[model samples]
Target: MTEAQRQIFVFMIYALIMVNFSGSSHGGAVSSEEEADRITSLPGQPKVYFQQFSGYVTVNKAVGRALFYWLTESAHSPLSKPLVVWLNGGPGCSSVAYGASEEIGPFRINKTASGLYLNKFSWNTEANLLFLETPAGVGFSYSNRSSDLFDTGDRRTAKESLEFLIQWLDRFPRYKGREVYLTGESYAGHYVPQLANEIMAYNANSKHRIALKGIMVGNAVTDNYYDNLGTVTYWWSHAMISDKTYRQLINTCDFKRQKESDECESLYSYAMDQEFGNIDQYNIYAPPCNNSDGSTFTRRNMRLPHRSHRIFRQISGYDPCTEKYAETYYNRPDVQKALHANKTRIPYKWTACSEVLNRNWNDTDVSILPIYRKMIAGGLRVWVFSGDVDSVVPVTATRYSLAQLKLTTKIPWYPWYVKKQVGGWTEVYEGLTFATVRGAGHEVPLFKPRAALMLFKSFLRGQPLPKS
Candidate 1:
């Protein structure tokens, strides 16, 4: 691969890492309490929760990590209910961004300062819904020391997040025994599984275990090459990429030989290379607004200083809800703080909120490969779901990645209809059932909440889905 192509692939590597993307080991244990305290405190930082709209913040006394999350009690029925934790992509995206504000949270935001609005179809009503800003770096979670952003990568994040959950559930012990499900879209595909794996492993290994029922990933980024190739075909099928261009690119383009000829440019430039914005080439989901200011990666503060999900553009706009949750989040007094990304790194430009991660390449894949097979061998159910429209981690890529399974097709592939249309489909093979969300893009919850929720509900019950 050329230097540029290598960087493009690197982007994919990090996305995989970020998304439940796993990586090499990080030294364990949160810094000592005294060390956490001695980091020159930003004390009295209150967590914000939604309803009773709670997106409240809390510190894990055990780990000295700060976590921000939203919770809902709208479920009139809480009898042995399943507690679902939803995640947004970005490896660093806020679940609160799409999960709470747009997808299944209890409330939605209005852009024009109309205040919080109740979602007519919030998912929490069926089950207790929760959204969290994990890993101490993403979303409202922060540390007094700027260097706190440095400990990123898959392994550390996975452990820290599990620690966070254990700590959080410890704090809210009432729901510890509740059937728990992990759900997310885009990059979260990796996050949900990896996190689920950790929870499952911990429960299995620990003396005092926990209950983690199942996991669900939507339009996930579980694999890179297949997802990318899937993108080429999906775009071509929809005329986004013409047949001649597709043929020319496919015939010459090669992942193994990215350093070859002009075909390298086709995959590098054509595959990515947006005309504007400095989003990581591998991350196809929308990025935080590009600041008009001439700031370099670190200079550009990702804080909305306004709305996180700005509805400034209306191309086939699905919803306009910037105002409702903007203050609930981006407007949080803490988020408005200045960018402390890199003091000595590039100082003129901007990077996304999770930009600090851009500095290091976290290319470590998960170590749970054997565990997955082990789970199936033990009669455990492992279901992986996909969204068809995601370009970053396309459905095609997921299919290609899982082909490695070579498992038997226990339940044959079939169309899964929603709203009387091709709202994607499903397939059950071996011990895994892979499904697709039609018409939904990367953030399946925001684009297709009902279908996504239905998928989770079915998985939780370990039962076949209802005919639409």
Candidate 2:
């Protein structure tokens, strides 16, 4: 052959080799048509303008452990929007049940407790939302290895979650290299930071890295000692417990050590007995759910007799039994098939929170402040929000925990407005931001959807909370 012909042939061979290499780099070519994971229609879902996908990402192939995720694309310009992964912290909670169904997802459970309705203020209006059921044995995600089920903890959870994200991106290659945000509430204070740290480490070592840009955690549990102390203070300040009980609690309980003397336990119990009398500890201002007889209490007249009897009431059109509704909706055979869930037909039923897993959770970090400081220093946007009214992981706890960081104020604390009304208070620091959702409980979005959306949109835009 002539020199010109040989050169042309070599160019064609090189192009072919590059194509193969590109495909192999992404673990083989992934089809854009993810029909297998698409939701044709949920059982009673309202007509929607956006697409939804739900399925499992196998994190541990040998153990058959997988983390389940539900993704809702933005209502408009999904391709241009950033992706936010939302997690709910119980250390064992299902983000699908809490974060998706009740808080920020595109849909909410219907009042009848068996169907879904569109959440007018869903976060998907602003960005693509991804909700994950992590660490196996939570909600629809499961582990074939029983030991894996019982042996999960903070570090393992972060590792598995990171692995899931990498594989998930591979499955939905369109989202590869997209700007990603990690957001969660409660225990996720621990999960989000730990997972973000892991992602940062992975990005440093790998050729393909997740474009994690920011993290936001709301009503989070950041430190054990501060959280506990704040709880007692909140209870007393709210007049839920007696002053004597409060003083006894402070003096007797060694929150830092996680050890309580026998007398401390007695004082704690007494304080709780006064504080929880027929009240939902999660939301102090909300009314309690009534029994079938329309009575709010049991016949025995005991103070806080049965915890199960403490039903959640509707607060600002939010239903506490939304978890129960989601449980019913997801367990339907048709719903599972439509979402591509329960592929193995895991023998166990799905629940909002796994009692076993929560009980068995190991390695509870006393504080995640160090992780936060590291991430902030690394230039990742970090925002912490709190629902001022939530008794569980209240705003006071978050304030105390953040005080540990000793961050200087970049912007003086101010009230953030929504629709010409004060929605919440916000404070901007050198490396972190703190905000509160007025009148919101532990689940901020559930109680204050409009305010929550405002906060989320601000976070995504890297703008301060609305000042008007």
Candidate 3:
């Protein structure tokens, strides 16, 4: 069958299952009050008024594959708030590591690496946040079938994620049919859209449908070619790379193909050498972590527990060493027991990124623009935001990719304000919206918490960023 036919066939199969599967078969009447999953209090965690839950939801029973999740209800009226599913993209990264521990989650790891502090700007303030460690082999998530670790990619990830959501809903029936917003950053550019598509496809034939209302991605890798080209331009424009190397990168590299020619690779290496040079590529403008023991590789590799320390620079009231603290906190026996994690005593330590899974990523779509197009055409709210200083998947790349969609403008580009200061520029299109977070990096919330929170609140409300 052609690719289109194959997709249709797959959709039909899922549709048939959705049509026939009785809610009772999946235990849809299961009580939402999961007292066992409730997290009373985490070690070193501060007192909080909200409820928290963390555990594994088996996505594939035959393979014994399960994904770990941490859910934090809103500080106020959590049941009334929308359910926001947050994903972190490394194709192998753990959302709990970065999304929860450092960025928008309720707590930040203390410098002692054994304690936690409240993150005043946590996204849960606006919505119930659910951070997942997806696709198995990621963080505390795992698979009984060892091969599943090496055999994974976007499609498998999306498929398992859908199953996870369905099973998760069965567990938290209160959230059933609630408006759900899918949001993530980095490689999740692929995860969020693909999963949204799956949910939409499944909803077509199901009586109990997921109320997927909108999606938001930050500094996302939407189109590989644009992302690569934009990175080169960002480096050159910021004077991080020499003009000569910049020219070589633009002229020699063919990002359309996954593999670059040896000549292109050489030029790219030179460009990277000039640009990185002890600087964190994720945040070009931020200071480098001075106390590096080389324990963290970077935010991208944060999922791997055994990977190097994160290159964190103290800025904007954010802890540079938060990942180290998270590493320490999660590994504590008491903490794990409190969170209901590591039940089977997996052999490997939890990491931020899975090197094995990363190496074995089976498929990557060159561009998720088509998926975005389909989602927007389906009338689902679509928003893309970028941190101005992120070199990994800079705002320039997002601009170029969105331009390719040729969306009509609903609101002309304008500056968005927060606390009487310019947060960023924003523009609304017929089917999508784009915004930038000034002075932020790949992880916007970690770098510019206030601005990121403002942006997020607006996105969740389906409103434009504040004009005044």
Best by lDDT: 3
lDDT (10s digit) by residue, model 3, range 165-231: 9988878876887899999998898899999999999999899899999999998888877777777
How far off is residue 253 in model 1, in Å? 5.2
lDDT of 1 by residue, 1-468 (tens): 696566456545544543341222222222232122221211122221212223223344544456566566434444346778877655555676667767777555565433456665677667777776665666666554455576565666667668767765654545556777787776566677778778877887887566676676666655444554665666566544556667866676664331336644644355333331344212233333332484322222221111111111211115423423343445433333321122222222221236564233154343234545665674556777765655545677678767766789977777776667666778788777888877665556666777877776677778655556
Clashes of each: 37, 0, 14
- State every prediction's TM-score relative to the real structure: 0.70, 0.88, 0.89
lDDT of 1: 0.55
Residue-level lDDT tens digits of model 2 in 1-468:
996666456556644653564565445554544557877688777766567888888898897898899999887667678999999877677899889988999888775656677888999988899999987988889999987767788899999999999888877876887899999998888899999999999999999989999999998988888887887788788888888888888886787764457777677666556556766566787765554688652211111100101223232225545655777787888878878899998888887777778766766677888998889888999999999998768888889889999999999999999999999999999989999999999889988999999999999989999899
Better of 2 and 3 by lDDT: 3
Candidate closer to the true structure by TM-score (higher is better), 1 or 2:
2
